[model samples]
Target chain A: MSETTILRTEQLKKSYEKGKYILNNFTFSIQKGEVVVIVGPSGCGKSTFLRCLNLLEPIDSGSIYLEEQLISAKDKNASKIREKIGMVFQSYDLFPHKTILDNLLLAPVKVQKRNKKEVEQEAEELNKKKIELDLEFRKEEFLSKTTIWWPETKGCNR
Target chain B: MRDMGISVLFQGNNFVRLLIGLLASLRIAAIAMALSVVFGVLVGMMMRSKHGWIRFLCRCYLEVVRIMPQLVLLFLVYFGAAKHLGIDMSGEVAAILVFTFWGAAEMGDLVRSSLISIPKHQYDSGYALGLTKWQVTVHIIIPQTVKRLLPSGVNLLTRMIKTTSLVVLIGVVEVVKVGKQIIDASRYTVPTSALWVYGAIFLLYFIICYPFSKLATSLERHRKEESV
Candidate 1:
């Protein structure tokens, strides 16, 4: 229960029926910048645990806190809590109608209310990085060219 | 001489009647398809709702539409509902209403399945991004649903074009009705013309439907190759 805790869950539980529990007495906490993974067997509820963390699934009983803000399982504001924790899927899940740049910029513009200019700058930087990575993958000699595009645009660096 | 003969046939009174009838049916089918797609997506989303009552209501709608034949449903709306409600409906209007009802139910099922086909991880990933439910739905869930649903919707559109012929039974003049008219007028003098007329009808349908089939398949293939 330190002041710097980014997420905390207490006694989180979920059950399909009254006497059976898929998750019972689950509790965990993670500080900001912490990288955590929950691994288990096929039906072991790792995904379910992630769903609970994101409040995508309703917990039968529990409380979750993000940055000192409490998230109710049934709260109308659950959506706001969802925006802070970006989760990359095993599948890329990129929008087909959108190009790669649009997919990356969608949440930032729509959810975070960031300006389109700022978002596009970030997108271009990411694209340049991707190109650099591709070049590196093909041959290591182009490592020097990685910073060639560096600082080409102000405020592009995340 | 052959071209002159064809132009003369085309300019005949019977040909004009057939042309008008076919256009009317196409108009009705197009409007109905548009309305049905909008209604269907909303209903389909509701069908997959977390709320039990919403899901039940949508399920009941699907069952009712499925159990009743499309022709019967058309008749009920055209004859029964119009009479009971004391509303005046033209044959074309009645056809649109009935087709829309049927289309909505069918489209809703397609949409629901498409929505479901989206990997569960997509939604979780959307949520992980701290997107609100509406944001996730609009930005993530719906876009994914569209990619999955478009192929099936195209298939449904092709079927709808063929189904528009059923409107002829309701006294709506469509391609088939016009073909029947040609056959009726020419049967005594030139019975062989019936086969050609029907063949023409098949060609017209193929022209309308073939592109949609190709589009559906290609889009599905492209989507498969795309990132999830």
Candidate 2:
């Protein structure tokens, strides 16, 4: 209930079959700038938990909050809440027909209704950063500590 | 009185006719394939959607497509819909509509399977990296699916090309129809010419489809090796 809570889930639960609770009464909260890892055994509901956070999986019962607004547990406004959250899969699910640059620019262009030139510029910037990170990795001393960091900075919201 | 030796392929007339027919078929297939690909990919994406009604609708469409044969689909498109529309569509237009529908269904399924087959971890990692769902689909899912789906798409394209011959049944002046015309005209001296004409048709089909088949198989094999 803190003012800085970026995400909050209360009594979250999911079940694939009737009465078979894979995730049960999971209550958790994430602060605005914190990174929380949900580690569990194989076949546990870690992935489901992530999906539920974004409404990718409908919660069987309970509710989730993003910022000051309620995300799930409501029928009408779920999609609107989902717009604020972004998800990426473990696999490099880049579109084959489209180039790497196009992949980066798609959501921004289509969903965000951003200018093509701006999106293209951002993609180019990311590409440059990736190259720099790679070069840093090759250096003898800096290789150990080099990190590319997030692809996009938070404040650059367009 | 002696009968004049009238060779059927006097000079180069037959080749010109066949060439034109081949080009027309190619044009029709190309346009149909392009439109179908666009439609199929969109449908495929919808099928993989999380919403209940969307998924159900897509599944229903796929099942219907699977149950109905493509030839029947062509008949419905040419005879049924064309008549109802009262536009008096050309046979070629009817052929395009039939194949486009068929290709869209098949390609949609291809795209859906490819999209679903991607590992969950991929989506998670993309999320962990803070990319949006749309971003992940466009970036991570679609690229991998394209690599997987290209060969099958090419295969579909070839099938579409071969199937264009069915348009002949509806009176399209394709290679087969022209060949049939030649056979009917030269019913006397063209004894066994049907064999040659059909053989030529098969060769033309092979010429169009062979490279695509090779590309599909080779790309598939290459993907496997790369994965391994």
Candidate 3:
């Protein structure tokens, strides 16, 4: 199936030191609406790959393309690139100072610059929808973006 | 029959005088602390600057404040600056300046450490939700940092209060200075007045600082419980 590739990487390499590559010559690609699971042993570069894809960690030698735009360049704005990708961390990184309702509306109202009233309304609807569906999903579902699942199946970390 | 130096406080208005002196100390500490907490947050934010030069400059400033004694700073601001540099500042003002500078450095370090204590994933989570860098810092990072900063910040305030005693050396006429005056006045009558006078001053300091120490502990415990 010739699906449109949403994310693509070519020869992605990450190293902690010289001649020691954690992610060595790793080539990966995922199409829009596609879900890919990466399984590996401890310290086998699985987390490194996800972090590199999200632009959290710099790649040593490789190129990353998000919808054909080169994101792994030296001059690319990391924060700007990161905005388009959602990463569910192994630990559900909830802002402890804010309430659950405020947490839901925070990014939409502040980051996206959407109307607070509108965003709150949307969040209210989403909260109701989740309840109606009776789906016991974790809070990570609200933190929408890239889907990187870990071992615990919810909040997995090493 | 009456206690040696303890009687001095009740002889006339010595106790009230000491209270007023304490208020003066607190007054300077309060103003300095308020300003330091403001500037300290800025300094702390700058400590995280991507530019090596900025971090180095902040580090130097922090080290300078940390290394030099507060008394030296007071002399520099009060005697040296006032005499040579032609800066007309009162003892109180000088004390405030010295304490503020020192407190800012201390609070700045506290802020930096608290900011660092936050897990990396908090920023990642914010960015992943399409938050800009500024938004991530303001919404995600800062709130958590504030929670972590509070306990230490309160402890800093208590230290600021205790350190205000040093202002007496620069002739600020604060609590310790008043204690000295009381001891000096009744030197012949209460030969051991220094012991009692200083003891009361110590009691006053303990009264003010103990609650803050408890508060810091409670805040830290509350944070630990919540974060877990």
Candidate 4:
């Protein structure tokens, strides 16, 4: 019930078939800027829980709220709600046809309808930061041959 | 040399008649291809519908089209349907309708297979990026689908162009029909003309289809290289 609560689920229940609930009476809440991880053994409802949260899987019972707004309502536009939430899978699911920069800019430009120039600039900045971070990591880890790595990272980093 | 049947090519207005017939065939194939692509993309998307009944219906259409020969489908549309419906349909219209129906099913299957071939993680990532299903489809899924479908789509188009000779069976004066007419006219005057006339028809078809087949192969090769 805290004012900072960004996501909340109340007695949510989900089941593929009759009688067996994969996610039964699960109630949880996350505060603003909080990083919440659901860790459990394989076959436990961890993935199902994330899928339900993203509205990829419909739940049998209960409700989910994002920013105190009822998002799991049947009539709610799931895609519009999804626009405010970003999920990253364990597997890097980048679009193979698109370049790394294009993969980063696609959602922002196409889905969010943000200005392509602005999104591209933001993506460029993010890419620079990533390269810088990688370069730093490489420098620290492999101090022997900085020259060999410079040419590879220079194209993007510079 | 003057008595040879190959003189049909040099015969007055006969060449023009063949050209007109070739144009007609091209027009039909072009119109059918455009309509087929539009309908095919829509039906293909529908085939992936979450509803069981909808998917079943699309599957049934796909199977029926695949199972029945194109010539039979042409007869059903031109002769059978027109007769039962009490409507008069022109040979050209019937040919277009038949080709469109056949092409749409082929294109739909292409779209469906290419869509399913896309990595599952791509959808997951699209959704995770806060994209709605529609957005994910438009921005992420469709672009990939189009890329994957292009080579096969080009190949389907060549197949359509080749199969369009069947339209001549229904009395549409396409290239093959014109060739037969030329041969019949010259049969007595130049008995050797049949070989040359039919050979010309073969060359015309080869000209139309060969480039497309090459394009499809190259596109497929490019796709393979990119995947690697």
Q: Of the candidates shown, which would achieve the greatest TM-score relative to the real structure?
A: 4
Q: What tens-digit string does per-residue lDDT give for candidate 2 at B4-67?
A: 3234434248757876888878888999999999999998888878898998988888788779
Which residue segments of model 1 deviate by more than 4 Å?
A1-6, A9-51, A72-76, A88-99, A123-158, B1-8, B11-16, B52-57, B82-86, B185-193, B225-228
Docking quality of model 2: it rates as incorrect
Which residue window of length 10 is worst by lDDT in model 4 chain A?
A: A149-158
Give the distance in Å from residue A91's predicted Cα in candidate 1 to where it truly belongs. Answer: 5.5
> What TM-score against the true fold does each predicted structure earn?
0.76, 0.67, 0.79, 0.86
Q: Rank the candidates by TM-score, best first.
A: 4, 3, 1, 2
DockQ score for model 4, please? 0.52
lDDT of 1 by residue, B1-228 (tens): 123223323446856665676677678878889999999988888988999999999999999988998889888877886679988687789888888888898999999998888777677656665676688788888877888888888888888888888887877778888888887876665656666667767777788789999999998898888744
Candidate 1 chain A worst ten-residue window by lDDT: A149-158
Q: How close is candidate 1 to the true structure, as a TM-score?
A: 0.76
Q: After aligning candidate 4 to the native by TM-score, how far in Å is the CA of B116 from where it should be?
A: 1.8
TM of chain B, each: 0.87, 0.91, 0.94, 0.95
Give each model's clash number.
Answer: 6, 24, 2, 1
Per-residue error (Å), model 1, residue B203: 3.0
Residue B184, model 3: lDDT of 90
iRMS of candidate 3, Å: 1.9
How far off is residue B74 in model 4, in Å?
Answer: 2.5
Of the candidates numbered 3 and 4, which has the greater TM-score value? Answer: 4
